[model samples]
Target: MAANFGELFLTILLIVCLTVSSQGREMMEKKYPYLRLASSFSSAKARGYDYIIVGGGTAGCPLAATLSEKYRVLVLERGGSPHGNLNVSYLQNFHISLADTSPKSPSQAFISTDGVINARARVLGGGTCINAGFYSRASPSFVMAKGWNLELVNESYPWVEKQIVQFPELAPWQVALKNGLLEAGVSPFNGYTFDHIYGTKIGGTIFDKNGFRHTAADLLAAGNPKNLRVLLHATVQKIIFNTRSPRPYAVGVLFKDENGRRHKAFLHAGRHSEIILSSGAIGSPQLLLLSGIGPKQDLQRLRVPLVVNNEFVGKGMSDNPMNTIFIPTKGHVEQSLIQSVGITKMGSFIEASNGFGQSSDSIHWHHGISSAEIGQLSTIPPKLRTLEAAQRYAKTKHEIPREAFQGGFILEKIDGPLSRGHLQLINTDIDTNPNITFNYFKHPRDLRRCVYGIRTIEKIINTNQFSNLAEDDSYTINMLLNMSVKANVNFIPKHTNDTVSLEQFCRDTVITIWHYHGGCHVGKVVDRDYRVLGASRLRVVDGSTFATSPGTNPQATVMMMGRYMGLKMLRERLGRRAGV
Candidate 1:
């Protein structure tokens, strides 16, 4: 009887302990629901989701979270999670991620065929994981031009801001940048607002008070965990379509796991099931072309099976062109990213950052000069080539040593570029990077705008507030501009005011601001509702859907679009259920 009682008591105690522990686990799960991995989940087929979102990125993360509120949503990310990545978590390590070329690194660095070096995030948080965490709302003009519902856009902005956006604790360098911008006549300080006003304004950032970055992945905390499944390192290869129906419907997607094992997740046969491609500007269009949804001729050339004959899928690509002016300081400047922006009336935007430690590896002398330009210069007098090569070598040799603390301002042409580019597949293989040509400065106006942008930066640096920080007593505004211009051989000139020389300089020195957009633009590739034209239940919700690039850093606009689309889809689903 004693032994029986002891055993019974022990069993009862074990049950009680488990009950408490289980409750604890439930609480933890709710707190960090995004910690769950795709590998831990059951087979995709067994857990059919109402929505399967490809590219667990800036748009995809928020869209999944919003949809999961009432529907089962699965997010398939091509890269690993950003939850614990120090390179992603810390504000100072911003450029380290951009320069990282590792296969597993969240930032995937790629050089364009046009000889421009840039990066895009492969991690779950998308570009938000690797980019300088500047945040701002889309210009009201941009919203109205795109025909988006203004009220819905306004409502969606707070949904993202409440979770991740914060006003930056401006570092000393950022303060100087702001004062300099105001002094340079980029006036009307709007002060601490997310609105994209045309003036010097202190905007929002994803970095918090502790100097840690809060990414789009953090927005996942708002999701219904029981209904959401996030898969990391899950690269989607193709969109599976049901052609048996009169109109081809995106029924499922075939993706590869981290181990390279293939898996497919299909939509549940519910009233409204969808597969959204928020895979960014490049990835979204690339995936579509691979799935036989692009121009008929291009697909036929690659021998890909025809699914849709959309000629506009991989066209109309645009990226903001950046011209950087490096003002290397002798004193230690506090490390900072974009905080204050100078919006010029001349259709350019100037932004500054400090602590770019060795991140300019992508913008070296040898690599800066395009092969075409090099060839064009090969026939020139060896004297000019030697002088050019020597100048380039000298700049790198000087800058490389100071990369650890050397910080400067970047001036970007946010507007005035009329030229557009295209992205085409090298083959049907998903692993191969697409052929992207921005055709930057193909238009004369773009060159003029770039020159104007450079002149604007010259003015800013000449500001008494900014010039006081400069180390060289002899460094004049023209000298600094000339130094920047000489970085690219094609831009080198006999004199500063030579319009032809400056125009050539603009052509050669232009690089992407990493704000690539369009290719799957509204009215061309997708409709205003974000549904792919001529395809059912297929949609794109990333920057690719933008008719044109927003006049600011596009992170906020991208997130708002995700929130807007997710809510729209939900309303549609509810409406369908009610037989409305």
Candidate 2:
């Protein structure tokens, strides 16, 4: 049977692409032809390598690919390979794997605790394998908006986008959604958003003909590098550390391959040798602690002698409190809308200049505007601006001021912000899953703020700007005013200045959108340069180092960070040799 509806293609591709996992017995035969894991560990194994990268994930895959250009690089992946897996090739088939019900092998496994949020891929490709194909670049305003230098991120954006092949337009069958928002008073912002951010008026999805998700896995496959060795279904249980001088240095990695036997893999970082930890956020810290580089208390608990007393190593934990508003429209809209459109084939019309439709691929970007621009829009009601901006935005393509977007418009985090969660060992046994608590909505402001944000969304949806056109005669534009919905709505906890409907949404409706971040944050675990402050010759390169949470999806930004760090490592190596 052919696709029943349009959105199915996008929905399917978005689910499966480049997921990486441990190369276990379950899938020893189902890997890509070019890459394979080591069968058995040899004590006297060949150890002369320019660099050894740990954790083949969002950061690992890219780092391995980039460093291989000049150095002999070895990527240690704990998961099995899903390379050339057909369930992944055809977009429709990808959704099944999203189930993650494939019984995990001792050597190969992936942890999916939430229905929507997939933790990390225990496969050769990492999260790219299972994440919905929502590839978005870092917001420019998000970059230049503050913190890191603007020019550096600006330069890196082009570099990473080119490597990842960030799509430029919506796939065929996807509605412009831009038109639906004319009533909402929003506009197309040069950044990334869901298929559509504005109500009634939304945006389109980006995709290709075959509809395969294009993640780092695809990028590496395309590069076809010669010397890159990707070890799949291989688990790195510990990092061999040396503490003769009272400071431990990571000199090697202890891993278990498909057969469940242990092997010692050494890191030779002298003169031309080094080890870069590009492991996904969770894996990075665990490996570090296994190697004895995490918090002192954690290391002691595991009976693993600590080489460093970095309390912040695994403490800064933070994941974006990302939640979605599923407005069930009258028809089978999700499927019908997607199957009807493609990126380049669709019309360019949109509502807000800062909303959607202007750029086919990304929904928003950093417009690099001024404080004056922000002040100008400050007084304008968010709902009216959303409606007018979205309508005017659909007419043509133009850049909107990114600064005006400084504080995001997606405000549903009503209660105090959730406190950061921690990752602790549930069992010292490396194979056992660790204890991870996100401590969601722990802060009082989290519920309140989220409630407030939703109100804003409701206001936009209910306003005359939206109701005038969206409401029906049976339902006065006033009837559609959401008064009934609002009346029945409970934004906070009841019986005590709070409510229930919103509470359920807070506790269950939201989770990290595969964007878990800042576990070993800057100023706490590792320095801004991503080096473990107290430990020498050890560093983290994944999302663990994210200083603060990025309000949007973090793949492009994190991958670029890997690239940037790779270059910095090389340049610094050059400097150390030059005797500067």
Candidate 3:
């Protein structure tokens, strides 16, 4: 039986090469056959949408494909449709869509009350369909200090790098993490570019070259599919407004759809009709304090109904606190994510990932430790530790075998974290999770930029381009970065060690590189033409109008600020109907 017919002809040639690589990602989602005329929420309501966008994710699908190329947009999306999600179309199942704790997961897990767990990006190409897709851009002094128009942010980052960016072929552990970040001085190598340039470059990836991903809902195939609609689970939940004069306005939104039914949508009589939110950065300030628009004593202690008190709608929240290291390799590396970064002019960026596997029912372990036993319990001696003695020495160690969970991690984060926090709510349930608190490193210059980015990842694993990841070539991962370089810093605050400072090991290993942005910032809650200050036709474009967390991954400047604020609100509505 000739080796059982050569193992059934190599499992039918690996299922015909994964069905011809999933029909080349379904021929790029069949070049948007109008994204299957996206409906649902029980086939939507009597249409009236000259722009109603809200969280279709990653700057609301390029701001509803540049306001559907001239108004009539709608998009709503509350997860569903990363079209045939093989964990969002396989870049080797990227951490199975962020360890999918499914309740219709598209990566939504939350935690932060500064205890930090963090997730949020319920699909619809939001967080670029559960990120790791590392595209870069932003940092021409963060587009001339956010007053933008650096030639329309360089022509809106090549119209989103010609639709969901790519350029990544690197993998050989990202060429030894880009020769261990230019042998750790993090210099010169500007090799590839999406330009946020500082040093060790490579950046750009929405994951293609066969590992397919390309989201921001594939830039909605550059819109105008008869003025786009896109509905999917559709959650919105508030922001109706029109509060009878003294400046209130906004006139639409109150969603629900995935059969919890309730609708509403408005804003069509064009006086440059609006209602955008691009729901991110904790869903545009938790839908502006659940539509009462914040702080009148947290909308009268949650008995809601105020419209505009504006105590900076959920104040300045921030996140970018990451701190990894992990590495492991006794051999075979290859698999990747975040093609080598390392920007660091002391504000810290440094990135990496190579070989990410997971799935032993998403192998989570806090008290059971193992991520190389919490990177060998951060090499002990910080006054005889305590995370209950590193969980009893990672519970007498010894696990690591889900096929040796191969290597990767190295991260570092820290940029622009003037350590802020606030986002309260606790209820108003448009799918709960509010009380955020990114108070990490509560500013000591963000713990000296996370101990100078963990001493630049301990000089990028003592360079010599990480001397073939130590199988006795002795870079013993710098003895697990001795006092700091955490093991994915899985939330350490519990009677944390008082000193032996790497600033108390960056306040006992903070974590969250989900690159959190402010609550609704830009001159405190939308101004500079992103509207919303005291309200009108309300606006708040993504990353809650970021006050910092731009380059090195803020999804290509949040999909080029949703196509440069939808081509600057279609040139401020054709320059106010040609009156300009």
257-284: candidate 3 lDDT, tens digit per residue: 7667686778776666888888888888
Q: State TM-scores per candidate.
A: 0.84, 0.68, 0.34
Number of backbone-clashing residue pairs for each candidate, in the order shown:
0, 113, 1
For model 1, the run of ten residues with the poorest summed lDDT: 365-374
Candidate 1 overall lDDT versus native: 0.75
* RMSD (Å) per prediction: 9.0, 13.9, 21.6
Predictions ranked by lDDT, top down? 1, 3, 2
| Cα lDDT of model 1 by residue, 152-236, tens digit | 7888999999989989999877898889888888899999989888889999999998879999988888888888888888889
Model 3 pairs whose backbones collide? 57-126
**What is the C-alpha local distance difference test score of each model?**
0.75, 0.50, 0.73
Instruction: Give the per-residue lDDT of model 2 (tens digit) for 147-252.
Output: 5656555555566566544343542112323332333443433233323222222222223444555556544553225656777777788767677866656677
List candidate 1 stretches off by more than 4 Å. 1-31, 34-45, 356-407, 474-496, 575-580
